[model samples]
Structures are given as structure tokens and as C-alpha cells.
Target: MRLALAALLLIPLPALAGDPLTAAEFEAYAQGKTLTYAMGGQVFGTEQYLPNRRVRWAFTQDVCKEGWWYEEAGLICFAYDGENDPQCWKFWQDGARLKAQFEGDPEGTELTEVEQTTKPLSCPGPDVGV
Candidate 1:
């Protein structure tokens, strides 16, 4: 039993997913790209990174929200139009993709990058008439 325990301890553990990305790193990786995110293996939403830290986000096939992100206390916080509270997240780069954890709860929902493209997000007007 003692030898077995020693061998187990000697085994190398797997590395962590990744470290949180800096604001500049996040911008360089996300800017000008539309990225799809998944949570719990299901599509969650999509977001488009625009110039000047502007962003457009929407649920799957839902209306878009115009927002802007800024770094606050080493976290990326987003303020959307008409929204009273800002949503913040810590972003990480996992291999070629990105991951995000809500700042309010570190063990809560985690979002993973599913797809990325240069195509602009389609935001239909709230009211369209014939």
C-alpha cells in the first residue's frame, strides 16, 4: 500500500486548461470576428467583436444587443444598451479556441468557443413592415 501510494503521487497530473487572457490579448483574438459559444454542449449564443471595443451579441437567432466591453479589475465587463447592470467575465484561450467564466460565480456557467468567422452577425430590426 505504501509503494502504491508513492507511485500514484509520482505520476504527473494533467495541465490546467489555460490561464486567463489579458484585455489586449482578448481584443486581438476576438476583434472583427463573430464567435459562437456553447454551454453544457448546447449552443448558447453568438457575439461579434467590432472596432473600438464595440460588440453585438445575440442568443441563437434572437435580437441583437449592442454593447461595449472594458477591462475592470482584470476582468472584461460589458455594458449593453438599455441594460442597467454590466456583465463581466474572465476569458481564457484554450488551444485555438476561447473560453469564458462568469465573474460573479467562478464555478457557474462556463462558455466555450464553438465557431469563429469573419461574417457579420445578422441583426434583424425589432419591427419590420411590409
Candidate 2:
């Protein structure tokens, strides 16, 4: 009986109309897109959605980092550390706007897609010098 239950649990679930997007789906949706969003007034973090819309690299405030983002069940997750106890952020997009509920906060901020570049662009213009 235990084995049967386990088998049942392992069954692949279908993607619902409003269900969370899978990593593969997420990638397809976000890959090859450059998005600009504000984090403070200066605006930081230019995200490049790779083949999976995964955060290939994020640069902001003198920091350059890479990480992965995916959806499970019905929640979207962002992991910055890429290891144990990594900082996680959850959000959802409904075609028009994205609603993000951070891990520690009970509520999230809503953001609209202002602009998306066709490809990943370099941070800190050539004159600024990395």
C-alpha cells in the first residue's frame, strides 16, 4: 500500500490554466529577453531570461551574480545563493503584471513589464569600466 501511494504521488501532474510554470516553460517564456525593473530609484539588476527565462546573471550596486529561478506547484521561486538556505523570493505574473511575495514578507509588490531587450546586454557602460 505504501508503494502504491508513493507511485501515485510520483505521477506527473498536468499544468492548469493558472498553475505555476515549470522550469522548462519558464525558460521558454523568459529566455532571450532582457528585462529592466526598479529596486530603489537608481534601478538595478538587468535580468536575461536564458533558454528557460532563468536568471543567468544579475548585476546591481557593484555586485554581479548568477542564479536560477523556477516554479513549483503554484509558486514562483528565486534563489540567489544556489546552495542551502539560499535567499528565496516568490512571485507570480498574470500576463499583464507581476506580483511578487518575498519569502519573509506576507505580501508582495506588483510590477509591470516596462521594457524587455531582445538579448542580454552588458552592465556598466564601456566608459564606466568594470
Candidate 3:
């Protein structure tokens, strides 16, 4: 019984459903849209995709950051205006929605597209006070 259980544990788990989307596919589906994502059943962040690969992202109720995205090593990587290191993700289309996994860790957080709209993101600049 112990050996059987050990073998079961050693067996690799199944990968996430669906193949990762190609760069062109992602571009077509995401461009000109704003998407909100959730992780672990809680709202995580939102992002707006613009032409020329430009993007705007913000944590829930937080300030936004301007950025751009590109494909690298089969992952979609993003570079923000002031951030040095790029954040990379593997994206898969789930019916009308999208699922993303952080490429930095195979078992890292996975985000699900909770909402999408054609409207632009509401990004407020810094130091706005009465």
C-alpha cells in the first residue's frame, strides 16, 4: 500500500486544459479591450490592451501603470514604464474568456478572466487632490 501510494504521488499531474494561445491569437482577442482578472476567487487586477501592443494595468482600486507586451520563449511578457523586470505569463483561451498562468513558476497563481469590455480603463494620474 505504501509503495502504491508513493507511485501515485510520483505520477505527474495533468496539465491545465487547453493549449496556450499564440501571440497573434492573443493580440486579436485582447486588443482594444479591458479585462478584469480574479485569482483564488478574489478580484486581482485589471488591464486594458491597446494598439501597438501597449497596455495599462492596475491592481483593484490602485493606480495604473503603462506598459507593453511581447512574446518570449512561448510566454507573453510585459514590461511596465518604470519596472525593470518583465512579468511573463502563459495564456489560454477558455471559451469566451482567458486563463493566465505566471510563467515564473509552474505552480504559481493562476488568473481567470472575470470580466471584459470594449470600454477603456479608467486610469487616474498621480497627486489628484482637492
Better of 1 and 2 by lDDT: 1
**TM-score of each model, paired residue for residue:** 0.82, 0.53, 0.81
Write down the worst ten-residue block by lDDT for model 2: 121-130
Clashing pairs in 3: none
**Stretches of model 1 off by over 4 angstroms after superposition:** 1-16, 126-130
Error of 1 at 53 (Å): 0.1
lDDT scores in order: 0.89, 0.55, 0.89
- Candidate 2's C-alpha runs over 4 A off are 1-25, 39-44, 52-54, 57-59, 81-84, 87-90, 94-99, 124-130
| lDDT by residue for model 3 (1-130), tens | 9999999999988545668887898899899999999999999999999999999999999888889999998889999989999999989987778999997685787999999999888877664211
Model 1, 78-128: lDDT tens digits are 999999999999899888899999988746879999999999988887552
Write candidate 2's Cα lDDT for 5-121 as tens digits: 999999999644334455555556567787765543445456666554346445555443556676655455666554454444444455654323455555544333455778665
In Å, residue 79's CA in model 2 sits off its true spot by: 2.6
Those runs of model 3 whose alpha carbons end farther than 4 Å from true positions after fitting are: 1-17, 127-130
